[model samples]
Target: MTTKNVNLVSHPLVQHKLSLMREKDRSIKGFRELLNEIGMLLCYEVTRDLPLEMVDIETPLQPMKAPQIAGKKLTFAPILRAGVGFLDGMLALVPSARVAHIGLYRDPETLQAVEYYFKAPHDLSDRTVVMMDPMLATGNSACAAASLLKARGARDIRFVCLLAAPEGIAHFQKEHSDVPIWTAAVDERLNDHGYILPGLGDAGDRMFGTK
Candidate 1:
């Protein structure tokens, strides 16, 4: 489903993997592997529109002009802990991309995002930033992360996730309408405690076996 600034990746592979991840009984290994696979696929979709420039090159048999991604290397900024799960796969596709880490945890009672750590390339203004977080449930963390990036000079930012809740999307867009979102699915709604209904549990816990 496409919305104003959201792109739902309806690819069959992505959907299938996401379904497996959503299964409550899924093994930790399976969940982590699936998240990695989906991360690679989503990375593909998110970077589809990146600009390219042609350069003269010599092939094995003949000379040619080859197109390569234009501009500075991209920065993959993953919200810490759970967001780290998407990193390996995304980096597998764009190995040279820089990495930025943002650490924010939701306050248990208030459900507001509280930041404890943040680090990124100094040239954020010169590179495209893709922020990865598997679940966009409350949008509190996502919005706060974006604000942090913008304050650090990042102008081009995109958000990628496995699943999102309607409330989260609304809250995110309302605050950072300029940043587009790409996700595998948009779940029905968030539960009372800010978890997405039918979401694949706590992403950090599931991925890290912390629960």
Candidate 2:
């Protein structure tokens, strides 16, 4: 397997928010709020390398100059259901950014990912796409999502998740060596049930307070 650069976000704010989300007794509202906070924090790290162009603009009292993103073609693809939780928070920081949704439900018998839905905006060739999903376990969904983005001509693609398993990271690296992964934390392993061991349970369930 290729060595993938899986960034485990270690910022204090992110760490604090993740800690709160891990509390089993936390309310649904609290879980949702923490997820949003984590999303914004993760976004800060992900956008660090975005292309910036120097531009001149007038300040409140005088003329000023600064650098800003070169274009507005950024697209955030949230693997459906659980990924939606991270979407809201990311959009809070980038309200004008376009969004796409990909749904992948795993088949129990075959243990493979099955795509049920997909939608994205036009002209992705020059756009910077950031894919969001709360958990990266087995890496099937993420790999599929990244492959979809590549098929759409998205050369600059990145994946963001709240948590990741070592095996999943390895799988992602082997499948998409060029794509980079930014995650808040990397757990130890995946349990027999395909869930990340010591993970925060099912991120979708915790985010929505469902079983």
Candidate 3:
């Protein structure tokens, strides 16, 4: 069920959609739509263990007690700008969840992740933080982003991605063993350029057609 704390969303729909997205020449509309659909499904998988509490509610026929998510609400921290691709669909499922943005870019020559922007909810420490990034390749930015959130007082955190590479997961777990990861697939390896082998390509470019 858990591999190095990376939970793969293996539902049939997620599997099928991810396969479609991996095609060579998908349109922007198709890619974006499929990503959203997968995002929504991933939301279901990641938050499966959210704490719940009994609450009294009135049904159409009678009053009854129901269970609702309890204690801390959620905060979605998207590692931009590709992470933004998963934002809308995730929010669609958890409409009340707040969003945090962290902008980072990997340097071409050095492959170092550089932070360009950061904005997060003030009550991060009290909420469960779900960090979103479509691909986990080098794990440089993902680790840095997790550290940033911790420094800013975030205690409970998790990560979600569309596909993850073994090297990336190892690097990320080396830095953060407590924060669990969720992905649609655990890819085989990272290419020489720090890209996931057989990856759907640069997710941002695929979504926006910059490629």
Give the range where candidate 1 is weakest over 10 consecutive residues by summed lDDT: 1-10
Q: Candidate 1 overall Cα lDDT vs. reference?
A: 0.95
Q: Which stretches of candidate 3 lie over 4 Å from their true place?
A: none
My TM-score estimates for the predictions, one after another, are 0.98, 0.94, 0.96
Where is model 2 poorest over a 10-residue stretch in terms of lDDT?
1-10
Which ranges in model 2 have alpha carbons more than 4 Å from their true place?
Answer: 1-4
lDDT of 2 by residue, 104-173 (tens): 8877776678999988877777788999999889999899989888888888888999988889999889
Error of 3 at 52 (Å): 0.2
Which numbered prediction scores highest in lDDT against the true structure?
1
Model 2, position 193: C-alpha lDDT score: 79
Rank order by TM-score, top first?
A: 1, 3, 2
lDDT of each: 0.95, 0.86, 0.92
Q: Count clashes in each candidate, considering only residues at least 3 apart in sequence or on different chains.
A: 0, 0, 0
The 10-residue segment with the lowest total lDDT in model 3: 1-10
